[model samples]
Target: MAAYVIAYDVGTTGIKTCLIEVSGTIKLIASATEHYELHVLENGGVEQDPEDWWHAMSVTTKRVLERSGLPASSIQGISFCAQMQGLVLVDRHGVPVRRAMSYMDHRARLELKEGIANGIQIAGANVFKLLKSLAITGAVASSVKDPVWKYKWVERNEPAIFSKVYKWLDVKEYLICQCTGEFVMTQDSAFAALLYDTRKGKECFSESVCTMYGVDMTHLPRIVRSTDMVGRLTANAAAYLHLQEGTPVFGGGGDVSLIGVGAGAVEPGSTHIYSGTSGWVSTVVSRQLVDASAMIAAIVGANAGTYNYFAELETAGKCLEWVKDHLALDEINIYLEKKHVSEAYESPYESLYDYMMDAIKNVPAGSNGVIFTPWLHGNRSPFEDANARGMFFNIGLDTGKTEMIHAVLEGICYHLRWHLEAQEKKVNTSRVIRFVGGGALAPLTCQILSDILGREVETVENPHNVGAVGAAIVAAVGLGWLGKVDDAKQLIQASARYMPNMANKAVHDRNFKVFKALYKNNKKDFLLLNAGR
Candidate 1:
């Protein structure tokens, strides 16, 4: 009988569990999903009950184990990958003191601003402090506020909870504690939390930084590497998940790092692009590279042995879904029917995208002097400004619906290109791009990306499940079934490749300049627009 490993991916929207064979083949097992609402309060506050996450993870793991029919002993180990930067506080007895704040939550904006005003420098070094200051001032919302501020917010607003809390952690650490009854943190996660010293690869928490915000480092968990087994499943947790007591549980990193490993982008200079509800561009870096201006830094990778540099476009598939629902509901079947058809040629009754692509093909690349900024959900990385809104420039009567649609697609591609360029400048490497997620299935979009970036983009066979698979790989390593993460990369198979169309390179290059200028010209306008709110 073959042994199997269970991996859980705790996402922002839901939780997914997978049972995989030691050889890296996924078995058809049960999975569970639960949705939690993002409670939005006044003044940009967002919170969710931490219990909701626990419930989702527990039920989902049990469901998968029951469906697999493997005896508890046959399961070698368990691992987890979670959304990064969300904060959870647990009291001394291990009960959540208050609702956990989601990464999207901006409730602590004022607190962060005040911290900067009072000269509360985070991470000490001038560069890190500047980044933190930028974040507090709302210059870059998502990039600036991390779990640290959330912890500080709890300290100030819920002093009772703060006094009672014994351990403060990201969502992954909190869930793992529930499983193993151990208090620990992963290096990759800690580094991304902006609470650890990334330069020395040490678990040094800044006392000055914490003191400035009235936070005590004693509440933080002991830091561990991503590959280390932090603890074992306790009898209680075993009863809850149908797993054997003492099953080893490994410390895991954030989702972005795991996603890179799952997509077979473990090697340095290899890039992975995932488009789920949101989109991300991640590449493996051997060293921590910091860019003061771009807001790009090296964070934890799938394992402690490497670093992962990530940039994000806040909305990707979400925008597409919005378009599908609002503008192309009646054309769903038509679009699906033309999946494999080349949209290069114009036909009188071509598919919706075909018409759109043709309309833009003649628009002299770059949407014919038009630029669209994709800040629909607010910018995530590179430019972390949440107040930024999407815009279209160089539009005229000649710009029809198809042209507008094409411009939107081009705008997204250009945003990604901007990140890739910035990353290359910081790291000085030419990496092949691996495109994954639901968006990768769109050949036209993939080709457009290739044309814009002047690089080949390959699609993985199982983009949607890569994160789950990567989590399983961690479990396999913990079980000693795999020697290293790279060994598990053999499991990933490329389904298709999108090579750049050189013919359109010059066209895209010329338009890229205008696309690049849109932000500079409209930055003040966006800030002014947000002031009205």
Candidate 2:
């Protein structure tokens, strides 16, 4: 017997809903994507309306069901893999008080400074506060983008809304609340807040740390496991999504926790790199660890008793998206003008990227001495600097569009390599890493990543939907269609493998040194230029 589950991947820019069929193996049936807006305020605030997320989910769910030609009753469960560390405050009725603050929102600098950056410091955090956090939760809320500061920012600035807050939820929790009319946060999502104690047998919100941060413990919600059934669909949500009123809703995790599951990196020490709009290098580990200097931490995973040593790059494929809009304007206009040509492609960006890949295929490994910094939206791992910006360094008279475009791809790979090596300093990373996400669809990217990282890069089938597939796996496990989440490793097989080419090692090595030096040399300038903006 086959069971159907719809997994919604709620991301930074949009919502992707996938209908997956589980029988002997997991298979994707139909999928639909609907984009929403990310409002970027001048004050460094990034937000999206919770209504926009609901709208996209509704539209995409109907579209997926329609395309699959399946009745709503066929779906046994619903799950989600969403962007983490976002702050979604809702009232007692489960309605958002204001626009949801994005994970990228770092407007809480003042709150961050006042809360954790004031006294004697260790790695930019107050030493006393850092020690207390480490003792209690094994991690600290060290970044401005952390949800606690955002919570404080709301408490200090928008007290009226803060007064009405019932619970603080992440992006998926908000969606889950809408689906089931229940207020709960998954264990992995709770850990992301840096307030959850992940120690064995003590997996609950840390009262000491929460108190230290001045957060009202009551604002936190009850914690549930990724595979636990939160609740059934409510009548209102069912009507909006055109589904059954009581479909079981499973507690799927965030992208960082579950994408590796879909990548088949389930065992400890298995690593996977995700290159989406934002990119990250995550490794499954048995114990929690933190490298305060590198801004890397082993976050709780969706699977029980596991953690993901995670490092992130804010803009990965987004760099290419920028290139398409800004650099390839003429090509984009041409593609749009040719209506039939555009319709022939699946994704709107696919044709443009094909043109780009073809254009830069001949460019050499190092982009002819040109190196690009992929900090278009600032960087997080290996160093935390909100003021950093992206630029192309060492462009000469001989430089061409091909070299520049190729450099962007190389720069992204370089940053990923930096993250991989940083993780290696504390934990042993996989020699042959699994690469997943829309970016892995490109053979050129896989090869470049391999050449840059000096490791074998393998990609799985339907790399773009790994997040949704992970969510589906969670649903399958919860529904008893599968025994456990690790069963996905047997179901998922590698589609392609790219081995490192040692011939290009010398050039990449030279360029990488300069790449690291670029930030060290110009960080002061970056702060000077971008501060107070």
Candidate 3:
């Protein structure tokens, strides 16, 4: 008797869907995750087949609908969240001409520079700077360069695909078209593409820029807000997915902004730290706070009703995975088995983490004058240098596994602090830090963040799936089941909060000073290392 809303998250790895009641409770659903190979032909090229995403979506949506056992008419609305900056070109018949270059694809770096030299502004424009800088510096050669540059590349190199293309869109927009026969993009997703003017909230396809590059503005999808219902499900799509015709589909925002809503960061000054593959410090802001020098600004969200001001430190949980794979596989397996019998595993592999933490706990506050830079894949926000490399400095003969481990945690904390300080300068709001993602499960890491930030960090249960849940929240609101976004977030409850330890804070302060110096002292060296490469 109760109506339900369906939410789909088209992520970098796969498609995830959730069926939820109007009251924000998740019901039965299904997901289909497909892994695609990244093709790197040379130093700076990455590409993936667009059909992969489409196939994944079609299979996953059908699975969710079947698993729920609810008729298509019972579903009131649908919403989505997806990876940002991917470029997909579809012909006039709405078929893809080439593989969709994902956000991780970086082949267009030279093309990005060419656009910049021709009076095109690339930096401070979304993912362009990060991707291009990575390729130019030889830090990463697999990023997709800038979307604008990729657009140009297709125009010049594959004119047949370029000329026949009717819609050039990100993954989310492409999915919407596949579902409802509509070509539309949400403002937030567009903002991250660096193709939209965040200042004016307008699509900025310069006639001159397009003319010079042989790109037609007509190929771009019409922009809409996150909450806006772009279209209804077509009969063909409905039949394929076992859904009712005319089911309303709402335009969703990028993954990060949607995660903000999922984590309940809906109000100004409210901040959260997400530790997935990477880490970030983000706060909600009311206006566009542009930082020309620091690569900081207000990114548009699902709707113009809110803005997200944030900075990222490229690697967080990713580093831990690297360690697990390379350094402590045997120890991890032993700990996991021991954890199954006793309450010791209640922390879910915390014993192993604690063991690692203990090894480094005694190592002096600054890891005995050692510092680790967490730029393994290149610097992301705050410093947009892609040529940046991770380093361990000031290591002595006395340095051991414990010291290196401690230094890794300390370095990640310091990078997070850098972003938080920058965000504090622009937004003024009173809210505790909510920590989510795999890193939040580790008390040692959470406590370190709390001590460094000098604030209470609360960990939410099921942090991994918050993004999918947030998409469900949007679906609920769009269907008139929820009064507002804030009401929807209430469904999320924190499992525990970590308060700062003053003693640890004092210790971290000295190490943080050293960590800061490491960057200033070695930045030139990092740049020089990439020279002429």
Clashing pairs in 3: 44-107, 105-143, 105-144, 106-142, 106-143, 106-144, 226-302
Clashing pairs in 2: none
Q: Local error of candidate 2 at 399, Å?
A: 1.1
RMSD of each: 5.9, 1.9, 5.9
Higher-TM-score candidate of 1 and 2? 2
Ranking, TM-score, top scorer first: 2, 1, 3
Candidate 3 lDDT over residue span 76-120, tens digit each: 888887777788888766678888876655455566555543343
TM-score, candidate 3, is 0.81
* Candidate 1 vs. true structure, TM-score: 0.83
Worst 10 residues of 1 by lDDT: 133-142
Reference-based TM-score, model 2: 0.97
Candidate topping lDDT: 2
Task: Please give the range of 10 consecutive residues that has the lowest summed lDDT in model 3.
Answer: 135-144
User: What is the model-wide C-alpha lDDT for candidate 3?
Assistant: 0.68
- List the global CA lDDT of all models: 0.70, 0.91, 0.68
True-structure lDDT of candidate 1: 0.70
